[model samples]
Target: MQQNLNYVYPQVFWVDGCTSASASSPSAPPVTPFPPPVPDRRTKPGHNRERRSVGFLVIFMLILLALTGVGLSMFQIFHLEKELAELREVRSAWPEQSMEKEARKAAHLTGNPTQRDLPLEWEPISGHAFTDGIQYHEQGLVVNETGLYFVYSNVLFRGSICSSQMLTHIVYKKNPTLPGSHVLMEDKGINYCTGQKTWARKSYLGALFKLRKMDSLHVNVSKIALVNFEESKTFFGLFKL
Candidate 1:
C-alpha cells in the first residue's frame, strides 16, 4: 500500500502600503507606513561655512578682549612702581630737613661803603640785613653749620670818568684745613669804557657750594672805591639747602 502528500506556499502582494493577501483568501491585512525621512538641513555646504565663520569671529573677539585686559594691567603696574619710587625719595629726605628746621642757616647782608678796605665790608644789622644760624665778622660771612649753601652776591660799579682799566671781582673762602683762601667765583670786565666819561657796570655771582663749619667767605674787588654801597645795588646772601 502507498500514501499521497501535498504542500502549499504563501503568496505576497504589493500595494501602496506593506499589506499582505493569501492565495486561498481574497481579504488582506493593512499595515501603517513610516513617515518620510526628514531632509538633513545641517549637511549643506553654505550652512557649514556660515557656522564656521561665526565661530571664528567669536574666538577672535575673545582673544582681543584678553589682550586688552593684559595691557591695562601692565600699565597700572608701571604707574604704581613710579609712584613708589617718588614716595621713597621724599621719605628719605624728610628726616634731614626736619632736624634742621629750627636752626636753618641763612644770611643776607648789605654793602657798607664807610669801611673802605681790601676785602669789601657789609652791614649785618641794618636795612634788609639779617643773619640766622650764621655769623658775620671781620668783613666776611662765617659758616656755623656745615652743609650745602646757595651763595649769591651782586656789586654795582660807577665812575665819574672812564679809566679803561680791567675790573676783577672775586669771592673766596678760608678754612683751617687749607693754607690759603680758595676762590669760589670770579668775574672781570676789560676795556668796558674808553676815554673820560660817566659809566656804570654791574657784576652778579650766584652758585651752590658745599660749605664747612668755621669757613669764612669774603668778596674782594680790584678797586674798592668803585663799588656802590646802595643797599639794593650791592648785596650778599646765602641759605642752607
Candidate 2:
C-alpha cells in the first residue's frame, strides 16, 4: 500500500525530563571554569604603591648627594679666602720693614788726628761733606744702639829727614764702666823709612767691632804733627750691620 517516498529528512530526538535540547546537552561534560582568569596580578593596588615608593626613594638619595657636593664647594671657597687675607696682610707690612732697614745708623769722619790724648779729638768736615749719625758727638762717634759696626782709620806720616822713629797709631773705645779707653785696634811702624830725603809712610786700621750703647770711639796717633789733614788721604768711619 505504500509507494516509496525516496526523500531523506533530518531527525530530532529528545531525552527524558529535558525542557530544551541546549540545556540538556549533557552539561558540556562538566566544564572546569578556567580559574577566574588569574585577576592580572601585576596591576594590583599594593604592588603599584611599592613601585612608586621605590621611585621616590631614588629621587631622595639623588637630592642628598647634590646637597653634600654643594657644601664641600662652599667650604673650599672659604678656606681660599682666608689664605688670601693673610697674604695681603704680609704684603702690607713689607714696605715698612724695608724702610726700617734703610734708615740705618752710620757715620763718616775725615782729616788727621787733632789731639794725641787717649781719647783723641777729630776735625769734622763741613756739613753735607761728611755724614754722621744722630748719636755722634764732638771729638768722637758715640754709639746709641747696640750692634756690630765696621770701624776704619787711615794716617799718613811724612818727614823731610828719615828719623826711622817708631810711629804708633791706635783706635780706642771708651765707656762709663771702663776706667780708661780700650784699644780697639793698633799699629806700629818701626824703621819704616830707609832714606833721609822726603820720606812718607801710611798706616791703616780697619776691623769689625761689637759695640754697646753709650760707647765712644776715637782715633789716636803718637805725633799729631806727622798726620796729613787731607780728607781723601786720612779718614775714619763706621757703619752698622
Winner by TM-score: 1
lDDT of 1 at 4: 62
Q: List runs of model 2 lying over 4 Å from the truth.
A: 1-94, 112-119, 125-129, 132-134
Best by lDDT: 1
The global Cα lDDT (0 to 1) of model 2 is 0.77
Q: How far does residue 1 in candidate 2 sit from its true spot (Å)?
A: 99
- CA lDDT of 98 in candidate 1? 88
Local lDDT at 223 for model 1: 93
Query: Which ten contiguous residues of candidate 1 have the minimum total lDDT?
Result: 23-32
- Model 1, CA-based lDDT: 0.88
